[model samples]
Target: MGPSVAKLASHDRVWQSIRQSAAAMVAEEPILASLVHASVLNQLHFEDALNYILAQCLGTAEAPAILLHQSFDELTTAHPDVGAAARADLAAVCERDPACRSPLEALLFFKGYHAIQTYRLAHALLNKGRRPLALHLQNRMALTFGVDINPAARLGRGIMIDHGTGVVIGETAVVEDGVSILQGVTLGGTGKDEGDRHPKIRRGVMIGAGACILGNIEIGARAKIGAGSVVLQNIPPGCTAAGVPARIIGRCANTEPARDMDQGFDDVEA
Candidate 1:
């Protein structure tokens, strides 16, 4: 098949899966049939469904649902990569999170997935110098999803924020592709420091829940940060760091710590 036809087929497959899931949800819970139809079955495309869902979650008395929906639609249409990243995030969550059953589940119900997609749109707006609107969306995302990621934060695709509540990614933080961060993770800076602060999390890094990486430190690729550790310095590639002021404990056994989702520090030396 031609490239365009293949792309169309892929989209159709995703839409079909989502529709089937929505139909099953309606059959199982007759009371929520209207909600299912409005959020999923009534939509024409993936972006449209996303717009509807985000509007429902983020809309306020001041902003209103239709305005939020239009903004989301415009962002998805303007930057195709936002939609592509949303799909990749869904796949990442499905593969990484044990609770995720299907792409439809991640797309429809995962707050982490929802937060990241909203962040993508806010990031786009920030890049366009629409600071007020971007910050507004960022605030709404934090209020609705319990995840506060700055609009200026640079994040790559295939990110999984498992149990994303209380996750805070600072303005200058840079999260590369294939990074998995658990709840209460803070990629913040030393107090009152200006310019290019916050951590740079490289590819394939798995950060355990409640880990705090501070300053402008570089977390090298495939590194693992243990749960509740406070990272204050650069972590070398393939290393494991843990403790209050996290130290390089030992080497990581797996090359792809993010994909592996291994939080064990059993083999690491004290």
Candidate 2:
């Protein structure tokens, strides 16, 4: 199928799956029937349902739900890639997260997924020079989801952020496609340096939980960073880095560490 048609079909499949899951949820838990209908069954498309849920979660007294919904809808319509990236993220979570049973679970329950989608909208606004609105959304996301990603950061598709709480990505951080970042990870600068201070995480890199990657370093594609490690230097492609002031331990066991989700380190130094 053509690219556009394929994307549409992918969205349709996800919407159908969500509807089926919502129906099953209503059948299993009668108490949640109304909630399921309002959240998923009543919505027309995937983006519509997403907008509704995000608005409900992130909207505040200053920016009400209806207004946030309208803004999100406009952004999604203006830039269709936001929806595409969201779908890819859903697929990534379903594939990588062991707790995720289906795309519906990621859509309805995963705060990480929700945070990324919200960031996508904020990033779009930032690109359009709507800095105030973008910053507003960023603040709301941090307040609501505990995930703080700067609106100016560049994130690619197929990203998986597991247990997204306390995850912070600084401004000018460039996370390439197919990167998997776990909880409590920081992609920040070492000091108060300005202009492209954050790290550039290449494609298919897996960063473990509680790991801190600071400064404007380039983490090569398919490299693995062990949990709780403090990364300070550039890591070459296909290698694994671990421990405080993370050093290159050995080659990555898998070519796509992000997809593998393997955090084990055999040759890590003390």
Candidate 3:
């Protein structure tokens, strides 16, 4: 007797959701709708399609994922040594996040994903002396994504921003390697004055949800900020700061989960 073959369930539900989401996104933000359509069509897997759709709901560039992948590949080919670590950092994050269906998912759904990719493109433009265009795109990204990150900000690799809504990274902000941040966290300026007015976020730091770290203050490496904290001063390394006027409350040797990280998404498991 021949063995029975299992029938694959219809993917109509998934496709329908994708189409509806794409249409809604277009209705909301027509300028980037076509890009979202392209991203949805490009995905080969159902999970990837879902991820991309969810990203649209959360606000992200549908085009940057593809472009950044290509750019990263080119970078790896051209300067293998310099690009290796950054690429590895990206890959490592993807590996750790099982929800990441593909490298493209990592690019689209990860907040740090968009930020890092944009930073690379912006940095390239900065190097090429195309500052205006870079800044223009950066602003566009801020408006489109609801996360204002200046292209000129110097950010190191493996940075993650959970939820990412209301996150503002200023022009003079300097974020070092392995930092993770949550939604409503601001690395911003005190005023409109020209000098350095942004915060310097050191390596391996984690900023909790709705935590506002203002001015040119320094957040030492491996520091952690608790949810809803308003930091107006410097935070030493290995400390966790919380509350309105943030104060050191605990110690963190690793990434601390913020409130935004615990926020739910509506999706059934495959």
TM-score of each: 0.94, 0.94, 0.63
Q: Tell me the deviation in Å of residue 175 in model 2.
A: 0.4
Q: lDDT per residue, candidate 3, 131-250, as tens digits?
A: 875675576567656677887788776666655678888888998877777678888887787888899988777676787888999998777777788899998876767777987666
lDDT of each: 0.90, 0.91, 0.61
Candidate 3 has its poorest 10 consecutive residues by lDDT at 1-10
Please, what are the lDDT tens digits per residue for candidate 1 over residues 1-270? 245534554577877677778788899999988888888877777888888999999999999989989988998999999998888888899888898887778877889889998899899999989999899999999999999999999999999999799999999999999999999999999999899999999999999999999999999999999999999999998899999999988998788889878799765543
Clashes of each: 0, 0, 0
Q: After superposition, how far is residue 61 of candidate 2 from its true place, in Å?
A: 1.4
Q: Against the true structure, what is every candidate's RMSD? A: 3.4, 4.1, 10.6
